[model samples]
Target: MFLVTGATGNVGAEPVRGPDAPVPDGARPVLGGLDDPGTLAGARDAGVRHVVLVSGGSAALADMSDPISRSLTLSERAVRDSGMAWTLLRPRAFMSNAPRWAPRLRAGDTVRVPFPDAPAACVDPRDVAAVAARSLVGRDPRGRVHELTGPHPRDQLAVLAEMLGRDLRCVGLTDGQARAEMERTLPAEYVDAIVRPDVQEVTGRPPRTFRQWAPAHAGAFR
Candidate 1:
């Protein structure tokens, strides 16, 4: 059997379970997180053979001092030492996260957001899941770091305008202003984590576009 940890979207895990917590018993586990001893111990005790980590795909590019990147680095190290087959997925930003702007889009003709001009090869979650599945099924996908990305790239302004089919406007926010607004609820590191980089291709098939994803979930905008 296969167990997927931090089974949310493209995200990280904060293992808080104490070292004495119940050890997970399974044949295969997609262990996520390196900071928590319980999770690692659980995986080891469970007799797990194959493990996959859902780490920040491109977060490796960040500076070593960056906590997020540092944590991922630690995770990679722990997984390597686990003596189990491991697959690390490094997927870029998720197109699914675009819906975060739905409220602004519905409020007015202009959607106020940060990084208006940045282009992202925002990948579809489906593609990421597919790759994980392939790795989980033991297709000889061990000891590999896969950098997943969208098939193409597009700026938010163009994507929103096209999807809404109106003269939607994009209001860019200054770095400081954006930070202040975001920090009201989110940590500064999370605010800085929002990066968009264009990708040229996908591993297996053509990835979906924001143009495609946005319309399909148009109900969210309304």
Candidate 2:
């Protein structure tokens, strides 16, 4: 049987619930973290032959230099050592990220965000799910790491313009500036991680440009 971890997350949830395809009956959702040894035991008990791990691209265990990084590192190790067939999905920035800009777009045509020029190949959660589904059913998918991304890459301002249906002014700020603005509104680590370039590489496809994603999600901004 196929075991799906991170089943409730953006990509994993779509395969089980999205319109494109339905997960076969009896597929197990392995809830909990990789670092938890119980997760491995549960998979074994469930008769899971194939395991798909939906890991964050930013969570590279080999590069862990901090506590947060170490957590990711340990998780990867657990999954790798689980002795079950495995397909690791490391996804970069998610297209769902656009929602963060919703309020700013709703207020006006202007979008104020940090990392204005940082480009990302933001991926659709649905696509990530599709890939995962394929991996689960394929016999040869084990021991592979698939990095998922959109079909194109673009910056936040470009995405804003598409949503606004006109040229939207962007107020760019340094990391410090962004931290100051978001400190009261969001967790500090969240703001810092959101601006990383690794998000583009994990999502392998040229992300759907903001122009493409905007019209589809216009209602959210409106």
Candidate 3:
């Protein structure tokens, strides 16, 4: 059996809900995080031969310091040391994150964000799931780390323009400005990490531009 942890998160949801979704076919859903030791053990007891761990960006790890990092790191170690075949997927900046700017998208055509020029190639949750499924069922994926992303890189303003069906101005902010504006809106660490180059390296391809991703998800902004 293939066991997937973090089965309800941005990355995990695709496998749980997609057309060829992984969870329903003898695949077990194990809630993730350092706090959930039982969920991990239960999957192991279920005779799961392969495990896939979906982790958020290193920023979240860096922001929380060693606690969250150690927890996820330990979890990865446990799966690997358990003698079960495993694949570790670390994804940066989610394309679905566009929704967080929904209110702003409605307030005006301009979408402002920190690092508007930093250029992130965010990954689609569906693609992340596809990679995870491949790791679970395919050979040679064990012990490998897959850093996933979309097909291109884009900033928030560009993404907003695509969502609004017209030209939208992008206003870039410094880290300090972003923190002041977004701290109450999102986790500070998460906001800080979205613009890193690591987001591009893992997927081996540029992530999808917001122009491509926004139309389908426009309802979130509307």
> Of the candidates shown, which would achieve the greatest lDDT relative to the real structure?
2
Worst 10 residues of 2 by lDDT: 194-203
Q: Write the per-residue lDDT of candidate 2 for residues 109-194, one digit (tens) a residue.
A: 77766766655566677666766776776443478777665644566566656556677777779867766775544333244433
**For model 3, how does the per-residue alpha-carbon lDDT over 141-204 read when each residue is reduced to its tens digit?**
4677665555445565665665567767767788677667766434433554434333344334
> Which has the higher lDDT value, candidate number 1 or candidate number 2?
2
Candidate 1's C-alpha runs over 4 A off are: 8-34, 57-64, 138-140, 173-203
lDDT tens readout by residue for model 1, 1-222? 656565433421112122234444542445545556667778788888887776764355544666777777778777877777887877666777877877777777877676565565666765666666667773645887776666546675676677667787787788677667755543332444433232222234466666766766677766
When 2 and 3 are scored with TM-score, the better candidate is 2
Ranking by lDDT: 2, 1, 3
Cα-based TM-score, every candidate = 0.69, 0.71, 0.70
| Clash pairs (backbone) in predicted model 1 | 57-90, 57-91
lDDT, candidates in the order shown: 0.62, 0.63, 0.61
Task: Give the best candidate by TM-score.
Answer: 2
Candidate 2 wrongly placed segments (more than 4 Å): 1-3, 20-31, 61-67, 154-156, 174-212
lDDT comparison, 2 vs 3, better candidate: 2
